[model samples]
Target: MQSSSKLFPVTLISAELRGDLSEDVYRLKPGNSPDASVELALTRLGRADRETTRGVPVVLIPGSFSNRRFWYSPKSIGLGPYLARAGYDVWIAEMRGHGLSPRNQRYKHNKVSDYVRYDLPAIADFIHEQNPQPVHWMGHSLGGIILAGALGGHYLQQTRVASVVLFGSQVSRIYWPLKVPPVEWGSRLLLKSFSVISGPRLKRGPEDEPIGLALESLRWHGLLGRFGDADKDWWAGLIDVQVPVMAVAAEGDHQDPAWACRKLMEQFGSPLREFLCLGKKQGFSSDFGHVEMLVSKQAQLEVWPLVEQWVRKSPEVAAQLAMQPDRDEASAVSADQA
Candidate 1:
C-alpha cells in the first residue's frame, strides 16, 4: 500500500505549501458482475474545517489516458488541488486501464461503451454509498464526454448528483481542423498504431509513460480532426439535462475551440448556465494550454476564484452541505464512542 506521504512528494509546489491533507483508497463494486471490482485511488487536500466540508463536493474526473496522479504534481495543469484550497471537497478519479486501476477479466479492454456503462455508473454509485449526499461532477476533455453521455442516459436519474461542470469538452464527434493536412493524417495514423500496439500501456506514468488512450476516446467520438459524420444525436442528448451546469474553456485550448464551447452552452438552453473563457483573448498561451488551468501557477490567482464564487452562490449545494454531518464533529463522536 502506498502511503499518502509516498504517493505525493513534498517538493511538489502545492504540497510545499499545503502539506498532505488526507488520502484513501476505495474499492468500487462492479455494476455488471458480483465478483468483479474496480479500485479508485483518491487524495484530498485543504481544510477539514466545518465550512469546507459544508461546501459542495466536486468530483474531478481526468481526461482520457490521464490518471489521478496528474492532478497531484506541482507542475500539473490540472484542477484537483486548486478547488480543494478554494474550499470544495475534491475527489480525483482514475478510469480503469489507467494509473493504479488496470484491466481484469471483467474489464478486458478500453471501450467507449465501457466508460458509459460501467465507469461513470460505478463512480456515481460509490459516491452515493459513501457520502450519501449529492455531489457536483466535473470532467475534462474525454472525461467530459463520458459525463455528458452518462447524464443523458439513465445514470443521471439514478444518481444523487447536484450539478455538472465541463471543461474543454465537446459534444460533436467532428473536431475542428488543424493547419497542415499531412500533419493531421500522420497524427491519426500514429494514434491508431499506438492504440493497437499499446495494449493496456496506460498503467505507465509521467516518468515511465506510455502513449495515451485519450486519442482513442476522441476517435470513438469521431473527433480525429478530420472530416466525418457529426455526432449530432449524441450531442442532442445533452439537451435532456435538467440540473444547473457551468461550461469552461481555456482561451488557449485549440483541441476544444472557444466557439465549440460556446455552441455547447447555447445548446443547454437553460437560465442556470454560465460560460467562462480564461486568458487574454481566447487563444493559445505559453502557460495555459488544454490541461494547464488546474495545475498551473496562474490557477490559484485566475481560475479558482471563479469556480469558488460560482459554487458558493448555489443555494441548493450550500443547503445540502449544511445538512451533512460535520467532519470534525463526526470524527469526535466516533472517537468518544471508541
Candidate 2:
C-alpha cells in the first residue's frame, strides 16, 4: 500500500454561479507516484441555495479522451447540472492530464492502475470530507472501468459508496488476435513507442490518452491475460462487490456492446442491481450510442430521469427491477414513471 501522505492539500481555484447551478473547481496534487505534480480538477455543481441540496452527493466521472464537458457542456445541458438542479450535490472529476487538469511530470506513463490506486481515492477522500454521506458514483466508458477497478481492488470502501452506475462500460470488448503471443508482444511494443493516443488528432474526443493505458489494455486482452493488472486481479475481485449497481448499455454502442456490459454487471455480488439496454426495440426513442447514451437530447428526456430514480428511489426498486430478468428501458421507464 502507498503512504496516505501522498495526498497534498486541495486548492479551490474558482467558484461562481452558473445560471441555477453554483460551480466550484478545485485542484489536487499527489506528492508521489509516476507524477508528483499531476493535478486533478474536481468541479462541483449544486443549487445556488445550499439548503436545497438535500440529496446524497453524486460523483460523475467521464470516460477516456473526455473531460467534464462530457458530463456538463458549456451550454449547461449535460447530466451534472441536471442532477444538481434536481437537488443532488454533483461533483465531476477530471482524470490527471485531462480537461482543466494539467499534464503531470510523467503524464505519458500513466495507466488505469495509477488512476484506481491513486487518483480515485484522493477524489473520494476530498468529496467525503466535504459531504459526509455515502456518495453515488456514475461513470461512462473507461471511467466506469476505472471505478470498477477501484472497487474490485478495495481502493474504495463499499461503505462510502451508496451506489454505482456504469454507462456503456465493459472490459470484454474482446479482440481475439490480441490473445496471440506474437500479436500481444508486437502491440505492446508499438504502444510503448508512443507517448499518447491523441484524441483531437484521431477525432475521437477533446483529450488524449496515455500510451500506458493502451499497453495495460493490451496485457489484459492478451492470451495470458485475465481482467487484472500486474499487481491486482480486479475482475476476479468484482465477484465479491456488494454495493448496489446499475449497469446501462446502448444497443447502438459497438465500442462496448450491451452483452459485455451485462456480463460485467452479472459478475457483481450485489443483490440490488439492474441492467438497462437502451434502444428503440427496448422502447427508447433510439438506439443510443456510446456518447449519446449520456449526452444527447433524447437521453435528457428518457434516460436522465431513470438515473434520478436509481439515485433517489428506494433500493427495493432496483432489487425488484433485477428480479424481472427481462428488464430493459421499457420496464425502467414504467417503473420510474410509476
Candidate 3:
C-alpha cells in the first residue's frame, strides 16, 4: 500500500467514484512522530472524467471538534465537492483521530504543536509531490490556527503555500479571566483531568478534542504567554510570514468575535492580506455566525462564489476574472492553464 512517490510513505486506503466526482482517500503515517503513532486521513476530490484538465490544488482543514465532513459530507454535498466540480483538485484533511483517521496511541495527548511540527508539513509534502504546483490552503477556526502555527514556526515554507483563506479562524481572542494566573493555571489543571473535550455533549461541534489542545490554549492565553512553543515565539514569528492571507469573520459569531478575528489577521506580515467581516453593514444578506460563516445556505449564495473567486485569484485566474466579469472561470480554467 506504500506509495512509490518520493518523500514519506503514503498508503492509499480507497479510491472510487463518488457520484460524478472521484474520491481518493489516503492515510499518511508520519515516521517522525513514532511516539504518537498518528495516521492522518486525507480525502481528495476530483473530476470523474480523468481526461479533463485539473485546476489548482486546494487543501481544506476543519476546525476543532470537527471532521472531514465539515468540508465534505457522506452525501458528497459540501464545499469540497463544489470546488471539485469547479475543476479544482480539492483535498480534505482530518487531523489526528478525527473523521476517517482513527484514534492514535496519543489521541488524548494531541496538540497543535504536533500538527504544526509534523502533520501539516507531511500533508504539504505529499500534496506538492502529487501536483508540482503550489497549493492553496484554507482552514476554519482551530484548523486555521494550526496553519498559522505551521507558518509561524517555520515548519511550512511560505513558498509552498500559494494563498491562504481562513474562515472563522483567529488566535487573538482575549479571555479576561485567562489573564489571571490562578484562573489560567486552575483551568489547565481542570482540563488536564479529562482525556478529551466532547464536542456534541458540549454542543461545540461533531468531533471531540484532545485535552492537550485546551492546555496549549491556556498557555497561549495565559499571563504574558505568547503563541509559540519552547523554541520560538509564533506570535512574533507571524510578523515574518509573507504568505498571501485573508481572514473571514462573522458579526453574529459570539464565540470568536470579528474584532478578535481581525486582530489575528493583523498579525500576519503579508502585504497581500485582507480582513473580511460578514454582516449587514458589509452587504452580506445576514450576519453569519462562526459555523454559518462557511456552512449555512446563506454562504452558498453569497460566500461560496467569493471563495471560488479567491481560489482563482492568481495571475491567470485574475486575468480571466478581469476579462469575463460575468462568466465564472471555475469551469473554464484548466489545470495546466490556471
Candidate 4:
C-alpha cells in the first residue's frame, strides 16, 4: 500500500483513565492542544453543493486492530460515504490506540474493554449532545462485539439509539471460542498478548495491505470462531435488548459463518431483527473472509442496500411489516398437512 504523505491534523488530550487495550482520553486539541477538550473535525470529500439531507446521526465503529480510517478510506467497501450521500450525519470513531485518538501521555497500551467502557460511550454522548436526536450505531467485527457488550450493559442506556447494526459479531466469546479461548485458560489471553506487543506498532492510514495483515493474524488465531456455551447463554440474556438489530454475514466468510450470524440475530429475539448472508456470486470474493465484508468493494453494491433501507425505514414502518402475518407460514402449513 502506498503511504499518504498528506498530513492530517490530530488532537491529543490528557488521559482520563487506562484499560487493558486502550486508555480513556478526551479529544483535547484537535489540531495540536496538549490540554484541550473534546474536539471535532470535518473532512469534505465529495460535492459540497449537494444539499446535505440529514437523517439519523450514524456512528461507524471499526473492528479490532483498525481505526476510523477503515470506514473513511477512499476505497472503503462499506456504507460510510453512501450513508453520507444518503443524508445521514455519519461519524467514524477511532478507539484509543488507533487513528487520531491515541492514548494520552500517561497511558501506554490499549484494551478491548476500553472500547466498551470509554470509546463507545464517549461517541454516543458526543453525538447525543451535538444532535439532540436518536443516533444509529453500526459496527463490524470487534467493533460489533464492543457495541453489543456496551448496549447489553448500563452504558449508553440514556442515549436514544435509533438502531444497532452488527456485522459478524456475537454477544459472547462462545460464538467465537477460537477468538477468545477457554475461560479456564484465561479468555482473551491471545488477544491481550497480541495487543500488548503489536498494537503500538500499527500505524494509521488507508493502506490495505497493513489492514489485511492485521486481519490475517486474528483469523489464524480462531478469533472469528463461534461463541462457547457460557458466552452463548450470556448472549441469550441480551435477547431482551429493545433496539432493532440487523446482523449480516457473508456466505463464503470463514470468519463468520451463516449459522453463527443467524444465531446472533436469533439471540436478539427482537421481532424487528433481520439477517443476511452474502453469496460469492453476489460479487463477494471467495476469500472475502471476515473483515473484508466491511472494506470489500462489492459490499457497497450488494450488502449496503439492505443496511441503507433498514436505516431509512421508520420504526413504525418496520413494526407494521413485522405485524404482517407471514405468508410463507400458510404455504408451509399446507405442505406439511398435505
Candidate 5:
C-alpha cells in the first residue's frame, strides 16, 4: 500500500471507536488526476473491535452541498451506522471540496464530469481493492446523478458494481426553458461571472457548489442537449447498463419530483429496475422531502429497512425482478402520482 502511495497516496488520518462502530477516516490523493491538488475523504464504519464483517461492501454518497453527515449524524445513528450494525461494510464518501475534503486548485472548475470521470472511479477502485467484492452503491440527489453518470459513461464496470440505489436523483428536473439554445447560452454566460454558488446565501445546504457544475448542466439541458459529456453519451448509454437500479423519489420533493425521477428510471435498460415514490398516498406515514427521506426519523424506520433488504438481496432479487411479468407502467405511475 505504501509503495502505491506514489501513484495514489492514501493517508489514514483518524480512527476511533464510536459506540458499536469503529470509524476510520482516510484522505486519498489519486495523484493521477490532471488536478494534482485533488483530495477526497472516505469514512469507513464497521462493528467496533471486529476485524472482519459479513455483508457486501456498501458505499453511500451524499448530494450536492452536503457531506458524510448527510448519511449519519454526530450520534452515529444514521443509515451509515445502521448498515454497519447490520453487518455490512459501510463506506460514506465526501466529494472533493465537500466536508473533510478540502478545496482543490481547480475546485471552482470542478464539474459532475470530473466527479464521474475521476473521483468516483478512484474511490470505487480503492474500495474494491480492499473489499474484494462487487459493491452496492447508494447515492442521494447529486450524488446519485454522479453515480448514474459514471455508469452511463462507463467510468464504472458492471463487474465492479452489484446494485445502485438512488434517492431523489434525476437529470430531467423541471428545467425545460433551459432546453432553449439562447436561454442556455445566456444562463451559462451569467453563471460564468461567479466562481461558486454560495450555499449559505442561497440557503440550499452546508457547502458551496462550483460554477463549473452549473455550466455543465446548462449545456446538458440546452437545446440538442443530451445526458452526456464530451467523452460519452451518458443518456443514450444508460440503455447499455444492465445492472439492477432502484430509483427512490419523494412526493414532497419539488426539487426533484417523482415524475422526473420515474422518467430517468424508465430510461434505464436494466430489466431489474424499480421506482419507489415515498408519500402518505404510497402508504408511508408522511410525504418525505429531499433531505428528510434519508435523515429524518421516518426514514430510519421505513426507508432504511427497505434499503437493507435491497442490498442484502442484490443480484438474487434483481434476477427475480427481471423474470417477473412487467407491471403496467401506466398504472404504477398513476399510483405514484396519486
Candidate 6:
C-alpha cells in the first residue's frame, strides 16, 4: 500500500555513445512515502545504431555493499555491455546511497523493506513505461533477495515481470546463534548503535550498507521469523507467483549454497522454472564461487552465453497477450572474451 504512491518523475542526466553502443543515465526521485527524498539511479546500455531495433530490456541488480559497477565496469566490459552489444536493452540499478544515487535523508536507517516497498516498484514502473514489456530481471546476492521479496510479497507488479534470474542468492542462510532470544536481542541492540556497515573496511565490496539492513536480517533469521512484513506472508505468496524463473548457484559458493538456492527456487509456483549448479560435474571448467559465478573468466566462456539465451528465447507469458515480442531482440552473443 505504501508503494502505491503517485508515479515518480524520471530525469535524464546523461546519454552518450561509444563505438556503437549508447549509454544513458537517468535519475528518478520517488518524492513519496517512507522516504520522499531518495534518488534512484539507472544506467541504461543499448545500441546507438539508429537502424538497429532494440530488443527486450534486461535489468541487472547488484548485491549488498555493491553498485552498478558489478554489471558494468569503467572500461565498458561487463554483462551490461555484453547484453547491449547483442541488441538487448540493459539497465543497471544502483540502489539508494550507492553508485550514482546519492545518500537519502533516511540513509542511515535504510532496510531491505524500504527497497522492496518503495524503490524497486518505482524502478519497475519506470522501466515498463519506457520499454513497455515485461522485464527480465537478473540479480546477484542481496539484489536477488530483494527481487524475491518483491515478488513473494506481491509488491512489484506481476504483469511487468516476464522472468527472473537469480545468481548466488538465498534467504535461507542459517544463523544458529540468532535463534536464541537473548542473543538476538543483544545483537540487535549493538547493531542499533551503529549507523552503517563499512564495505571496504570489511572487504565485502566498495559501498557501505546501512545498519538497518543487518538489523533487519536479524529479525528474519531469529527464532520463528517469517519473510513477510506486517500484513502479508511472502513465503506463502511465492506459491502463487506464476512467472518463470531461473536460479543458478555454484558448487563453490559457501555463502549461499546450491541446495539452498534450489530450496528458494522450489518455493516458486512457476511451471517453467530451472535450477542450475555450476561445477565440473555440470560441465563448467571450475566450480564457481559467489562472485565468480557471474563475474569470472570461466563464467565469461560458459555462463554468459547461457544467460543470453535464457533472456532471448523463452520467458514469454503463458497467454502472450499482454506484450509484443521484441523485434530483432538479439544477435549472436559472444562469450569468447576473458
Global lDDT of each candidate: 0.56, 0.85, 0.83, 0.54, 0.86, 0.83
Q: How much does candidate 6 score in TM-score?
A: 0.90
Candidate 1 local Cα displacement, residue 317, angstroms: 9.8
Query: What would the per-residue lDDT of candidate 1 be over residues 1-338, giving only the tens digit for each residue?
Result: 43223222111112323453444445443535332544444444444453325345778777755667656664433466566766666777677656665554444334544566666776666555445667888887767766777766545552476667777887543544433556555666666555333324544223222233444434443433321113334445556665666777776777787567666655653335667777665432433567776656676567767666766664464355446645343221111000
Q: Write the per-residue lDDT of candidate 6 for residues 1-338, one digit (tens) a residue.
A: 13322466777888888677788888988765577889999988998884256588899999998999999888787888888888888999999999999999989988888888888888988887777888999999999999998899898877788789998989887889999999999999999899999999999999999998998889889998888666677778888887878888999999999888887877887655777788887778988899998888888778889888878755653445224344232211111122
Q: Name the top TM-score candidate.
A: 5
Off by over 4 Å in 4: 1-47, 50-53, 74-78, 105-109, 171-237, 280-288, 318-338
**Candidate 1: lDDT of 332?**
16
Q: Which regions of candidate 2 fall more than 4 Å away from where they truly are?
A: 1-7, 32-34, 51-54, 314-338
Clashing pairs in 2: none
The residue-by-residue lDDT of candidate 2 on 11-87, one tens digit each, is 78888888877898988775546567878999999988774445689999999999999999887879998999898
User: What are the per-residue Cα lDDT tens digits for candidate 4 across 166-270?
Assistant: 888754324345445453235334334442434444442231122222323343345443222212322544656767777777666665676676666666544
Please give the distance, in angstroms, between residue 316's alpha carbon in candidate 2 and its true position after superposition.
6.0
What overall lDDT, based on C-alpha atoms, would model 2 receive against the true structure? 0.85
Worst 10 residues of 2 by lDDT: 329-338
Query: Of the pair 1 and 4, which is ahead by TM-score?
Result: 1
lDDT of 1: 0.56
Error of 3 at 91 (Å): 0.6
Q: What's each prediction's TM-score?
A: 0.67, 0.91, 0.91, 0.65, 0.92, 0.90
Tens digit per residue, CA lDDT, model 5, 244-297? 888899989989998888888777777667778899989999999999899888
lDDT of 3 at 293: 84
